[model samples]
Target: MPLSFKPVSGLRLRWSRLFQRAVIAAAISVAGTAALQAGDDQPNSLPPVLQSSKLRLEARLAAEQGDFLHAAVALEQAALVVGDRETAQKAGAGRQQLEAQGGAMADFQSLMTLIMEQTAPPAQWIMRGDETGTMTPYMQGVFVGAPALAGAMAMTFDNSRLSTAAELARTANSNSDVLETSALRLVSLPRLEAEIARLQKSGQPIPADAAALAGLTEVQFLFVFPDSGDVVIGGPAGAWAQDEKGRTVSTASGRPTLQLDDLVTLSRTFADNGRGFFMCTIDPKPQQVQAVQQYASRLQLSARNARQETQKLEELLGLQNVTVAGVPADSRVASVIVDADYQMKLIGIGRRDGAAGMKSYFELAGRDERRGAAMDALRWWMTVGYDAIRVAPDRRAFEFTGRSVRCQSENQLVKVDGSREATGKADSANAEFARLFTEHLPQLAEKDVVFADLQNIFDLALASAMINTMDLDRQAGWQPAVFTTAGGFETQPVEVPRELMTAAASRVYRDGSIVVQVAGGIKVDLREVISNPQSFTTAPEVSSQARNASPVGQTGRWWWDAAVR
Candidate 1:
C-alpha cells in the first residue's frame, strides 16, 4: 500500500515554524563529497568548488528519496560557493527545479496524494494549523502561516519549501557591514527608547536593524543599569538574513532570530492583566467526536471495509477548532509555537522526517505492539524545558536557561460521549519517539531552522515573563518606547484561523487491525513556571552583572557583541 498520513493540526500560521528551512548565508562549509571541474583556466579542485559539487549530489539523492525540500536546499547551499560560477549556475538551476516540483513541503503533499489514491476516494489533506476542520469530501490544503514583519529584512530564498546565521569572525578590521556572531549580547530597552526618541527628534527614519531587534535570537540575561536610564538583555547572537518564509534568521546558523515584537507581546502576556501563559491547541468538537464514537463502537471488523469505514469516521469528526490564549493570534509569538506544534505532528505521523534518532509512529508501529494496539488515540505535545530561572539577590539580573523543546505523550481514551480521558500509558515505541524527539531536538533545529526559531521564541518568552514577573522594568525605570505602541513598530502579523482541521488517514493491516493516527497539541503556561519558588534560586551575580557588563560608556549604540569587551 502507498504511504498515507495527514499534516498536524494548527499550521495555517505555521509558515511561522517560519515556513521551511532552506539555504543559509554560506555554502555547507565543512561537508561535501567530491572535487569539481569548473573550467579549463580555473582550478577544478578548489575546496569550495568541490564542496558545491558534493552538496549538489546530496541534493539529487534527497530528491530521489522524495525529500525534495532538503534536497533542493543542498543545491541552494551549493549555489553559494564563491570560486566557481558553473557550480553556482547548475546548483541554482537544480534548486529552482526542485522547488518548482514542490520543494521541501512536497513530501507531505505527495503522501496525501497517494493516500487519496490508496486509502479512500476523497482522501485526507493538509490544513491550516489554526483552522477548525470538518470531515468533508474535500479538505483545504492550506499550511502557510501569514505573519509579515514590518520592515522585515528582505530575504537575501527571498520562502519556497516556501520558507524559511551567524557570527563573529571579523578580527582584521572594523568593517561595520560585516555580520558577527556573539556568544553573549545585551540590549537596553530604556536606552533603546532614548536612542529612538533622539532619532525621531532628529527627523530620521528607524533603520531596518532597529526594527528587527539587531538580529537577536535568544535572551539569557536581563540587567538594569543604575538610575533608570538603561536596561539590557543578553544572549547568543550572530549574523542574520531573512529566509523565504518572511522570518529573520541567523545567516550562518539558520536559527530564527528573536524579534522585538515577541518580547513586547510576551511582556503583555505576563503582565498583571495577562493570562500569564500562552497556548495554541487544535482539538475535535464534542458533537463530531461523539458521532465518531458511535460509529467506532458499532463498526464491523474487516480489511475489506477498513478504509471505507475510516472515511466515515473522518467525515463525522470534521475539522477542529484552533484556539490561542495568552498571546495575540497575529503576533510572532503565536506563529512560532503554532508552527513548532504543527511540525512535531508531521514528524510523528511520517509526513516529514526528523533527525537520525527520531522515528515516526509508522516506523515504530511493530516495535512496541502493546501500546500500539492497547491505546486508540494518542496525543503528543511540546512544552517549556527549563533547568532553572535564577535571579540575582537584588533581582536586577535574571538568567532564563532551558533546552529548546520537551515532548510528552499519553494514550487518550475517547468516551462514548466524545470526551477524552488521558490514559497516560504511552506505548514503549511512543515513549521512545517522544524521548528521541526531545533528545535530538537541537540537531534537528540545525537542519530545520524552525526548531531553532522555536527555541529562540521560548527563550524570549520566558525572559519576557521573567521581566514582567520580577518588575525588572520598574528597577531599570524603563518604559516602552521604540518597540512600543507610541513608537508605531509594526511586526509580522501572525496568521489567525477560526477553524483547524486534522490531517488523518488509516493503515489497514492484513490482520484486520486499523490504526488511525492524529496529531498532538501545545500548552505553555509561564505563570506556573515562574511562580515555582524552587525555580528561582538566588544568583550572587545579579548585583555585579550590571557593573561588570555595563554598557555605561556606550551611549549611541543599540546592541553589541559582548565578546568585543
Candidate 2:
C-alpha cells in the first residue's frame, strides 16, 4: 500500500500547485477588461460585434497558452461587462475552437458553469461584531464572498475531470421511491454498476437503493469473492431523503446517505495517479490579511469609531480562498469536507452553538482570568481518525473501529506579510477549545447534519481507500469496475463555492490591544494511519463474518439484509 501524509509547515497555505502556480504564471489579464467592454461605456468606440470578436481572439490566445480557465474567464468577464451581446453564441464557438485545439471539453465547460454562477463583490464587505464584538459569521449566508475572479480562481480544480455527464442516478428526483432498510446491508460494486448500466441502456429511472446506495452509512465489513469478481462493503443502511440543506440523510437515523457519486469519486481518486489522499483548505488571502493587519494597527479602537473601524476591517479582509488536492474542487465530496470545516469554525467562534460540553473560543477567552492572553491566531481543523483496521487471517475481512473525524488545534503568529507561522504552543484557553471540539463533536453532529455527513463521507473514503490500499481487488481477483473507466458512472456537478470571507472578529482585550484572527482549513491525510503497522490488527471474528457475508446465489440483487446474530 502506497500511503503518504505530508503535513506542511504549521501555517502554510496548501493550494494545489498545479492550478495555482499556472494561474499565477498566466497573470489573468484582468486589466484587459477595459478593451473587452469598449462598446459598453463608450458608444463611439468598438461596436458590440467587434467586442465579441476581440473576446474570441483573446479566448483563443488564452486557450493557445493551455489556460482554458482563463479563456472561459475572459468570455465570462465580457458577458458581465457587456451584457448579453452575442456572448452565448460566441462562447459556444469559443468552446468548439478550444476543444479542437486540445483543451478538455469537460474542463472548459465546468469552468464556464463556475464563472456564470459568480458575480463581483461589493467594494466594501460590510461586517459587524457580536454584542461582545466578536466577528462570528452567520452560519448560512453571512460569509458568502463574491469576488468574481478570485472566487473563480480558488474554486477551479486541477485538470482532474469529473466523470462525464452525471445523471445523479435518478434517486429522490423521481416519483417511485423504491428503497430498503436493514441493520447490516451488503452492497456489491460489480452488481451496482450492472444495475446502473442496465438502467442507462433501458432509459429507466434508478431507484433509491441504486442511487442513494441503499442508504449506507459506512463500510463496517469488506467482503470479496474472487470467483465471482465482486467487491462488496456492508454497513448499517436505511431509507433516506433530502434534508432542508439538500443533503441526503437516512430517514430513520438521520445519518448521511452514501451516494453512488461519492463511491465513484473516491474510487477514481485512489486510481488517479496513485494519489494517496484528498484535502481541501479554505483560508484568508495573505495579501488581504496583511492589509487588514496594517489597517488594524492604525485603528484607534475607541468606542466612537467602532462601527467605522469594523467596516474598514471587512473591506480590506475580503474573502478567503478554497483549494483542494486529490479531487476536483466541484466534486460533492470536496464540498462536504470544506463545509464541515466551516461549520466547525463557526461552532468554535461562538457563531453557532455546539453540544453541551463544547464551549466556543469566545466563551473560553472571555473568562476573567484569560483576559489578556497573547494569542493572535487560532487554527482549528479536522483530520483522519481511526483506531485500527483489524484484519482477518485471510485478509478477506477487516473491521475498523473509530470516529471518522478528529479535531486538532494550533496557535500561530500572524506574520507581517499576513501569513501565519506556528507559535509552537497554544495557550491553555486555545487548547481547551480544540479539546472540547473533538470531545463533543459526536454530540454536536447529532444536532448538525453537515458534521454527521462529513463523518460518513470519510468513512466511505476509508473503506474505498482500504480496498485500493490493501490490494484487496487483486486478492479478490476483481478488475476495476466502471468507476475509473471512460464513460462510466458520472456524478452530478454541484455549484462550487466562491471564496469564503475571512471569519475574523475582535474580542477587545483588557489591555486595550486587539489581536486579529483569520482563517481555518481542512487537512485530511490518511497515509500515516494506513501505512503505520499499528493501525492494522488481527481479528478472527471478521474472518467468520466474511465467510457468510457473500452475495453469492443472490444474483441480480445488489443489496441484502444480514442474517440476525
Candidate 3:
C-alpha cells in the first residue's frame, strides 16, 4: 500500500513554521523585484541565465520552507528559462515531489471540508486524532477505562509451506491451479457494546485518577482467517444511530472513551453516520511517519518508472492491425485443444502509451515482482532467518528441487539460492539461536512485542524441520513437517483439516506452544422495567397467611365447592 506522507523526523514543525515565515518574506521580495523590473519597461527581458539562476534559488528556498507546491512551480519556470537537460531533470523531479505532496494536500483539504460542512452541535463534534485523521465521537463515559486498541498488527507466515507456495506462485505453470483462501470473522460486536453500556450506566462510581483507570481493561481480539493470502485492511462500517432526543449516551462518566465496544454498537445500529474505524495513536511519533514516508516514496518511484517504460513502448510499436473475436454462447476452447492433441500455446500482447517503445508488459511486471520478492526474502533471512529456512534447509536442499527463477530480462532467468544449515537439539545451534534472539528482542519489541517469541521459534523449528525433511534422494509424497505442540483445548473443524484449526489458534496465541483460541468474551444489556415485580416463592409466615383447602368428598366438600365458585 502507498503511504500518505513523509513524517518530518527530529525537526519540529515549529521550526518548519519559522522557515515558512521567512520563505513568505522571500516570495514578497520576489514580487517587489518583478514589479520594479516591469516598471522600467527596458525590453522586459531578464537574461535567461540570470532568470534561471534566480528561479532555481527560489525553488530551493521554497523547498527548505517545505512549500513543495511553490517549489515545483519555481522549478518549472527554471526549466523553461534555462532550456538545459539538467534543468529539465530537476524540474521533472520537483514536479514528481509536488504530485506526491498533492495527495497529502488533498487529504488536508478533505478534512477541513468535512469540519466546515458538519451541522452537528459544537460539543458534539468528534475529536480528530492527529496521527490517523480519525474522528472520535464523545462517549457518555470515562476516558480512563481500558487500554485503547493501538499499534501495528503483526504479520505472520507459516514457514513450513511458504517456500512451496512461493515457488508455485512464481511458476508459469501454476497459473491454472487456483489456490484459494477465505477470510472468516466471528463477530459479537452487538453483545460487547450492550455490556459496556450496561456497566457504565449502573450508577457505579467513576475512577478518580489515571491510576484508578487501570481498572478499565481491554482484551486483544485476534481474528484469524485462513492464511490463504495476505490480509489487507477492509473499510469500516458506518456510525451508530441516535434516539428521538438525539441522545447517543453510551457511558455515564461524561467523558468520552470511544472503544471497540462503542464501535461495535454503532456499527450494529444506524451505521454510515458515526466516527468510522481509523488507525489512531495517542502520540504521533516520528518513527511512524518515517515508515509511511519510505513506503510512499517507493510507490511513487515505481509509478514514474512504469510511465517512462510505457511511453518508450508506444514509440517502438508505432501502430498495429487489430482483430476482434466473437464466440457463441456455447463455444468451447477445450475442443480446439483436444482436436490438436493438447499442444501448449503461449501468447504475448505488446501495447504502449507513448513515443518510446512497446514491450510485453506482464512479463516485465512478473519479473519485477519476482525480483522484489527475492530481495525481501534475503532481507528477511538476515533479519528474521526464518524466511530463508522456509525456502532452503541447507546448501544441498537448495540445489535439490531447482530453485524458482527471478527473471531480470525476457531471456535471463536468475535463481536465488539461499541456504542456512538447520540443526535441531544440537548444542551449537541452540546456543546460536539463543544469542540471536537475545540480540534481536529489543529491536523486535519496538515493532511488535507479542509475536516476537513466536517468530523466533518459527525461525528455529522451520529451519530444523526443513533440514531433516527436504532430501532429493527421498521419494516424493513426503508429509509436510510441522512443529508439534505439547497439549491444550481442541475444537472440531466443520470441514477443514485439524491442522488448519490449530494454525488459526497459533495466529492468535503469542506463545506458539499454547493451543488457545480467541473467542468472543462477554456481553450484557440493561433496561428499566416498567411493571411491578412478582415473587414465585413464599416465606413460612407468608405460607401460613395463605389459605388451605379441604377435600371434595368430605363434609367440608360443600364449603370447598362454595369457595371454588
In terms of lDDT, the best-performing candidate is: 2
Cα lDDT of model 2 by residue, 229-279, tens digit: 667777777778888777778888788878888888877766523333455
lDDT of each: 0.50, 0.51, 0.20
Q: After superposition, how far is residue 4 of candidate 3 from its true place, in Å?
A: 30
Say which prediction, candidate 1 or candidate 3, comes out ahead on TM-score. Answer: 1
- Model 1 clash count equals 37
Put down candidate 1 lDDT per residue, 195-223, tens digits, no spaces. 66777789897666665667676766666
Candidate 3 vs. truth: CA RMSD?
A: 32.7
The C-alpha stretches of model 3 lying farther than 4 A from their native spots are: 1-187, 205-565
TM-score of each predicted structure versus truth: 0.63, 0.65, 0.17
Counting only residues 3 or more apart in sequence or on different chains, how many pairs clash (N, Cα, C under 3 Å) in candidate 3?
13
Q: What is the lDDT of residue 515 in candidate 1?
A: 53
Candidate 3's residue-wise lDDT over 1-565, tens digit each?
1111111011010001111100000000000011111123222166887676555554443332223344445556666776766655655554544344321232333322222222122101112244322222111000101111111111223232322322222111111111111111111222222333444568443222111111111111111111221111111111222223332211221111122322222221111222221110011122332332233223322222434432332222222111101111111111111111100000011111211222222222222222221111000011111111111111111111111100110111111221111111112221232233334433432333122222222222222222222221122222121111111211111111111010001111121111111100000000000000110111112111101111222321111111110
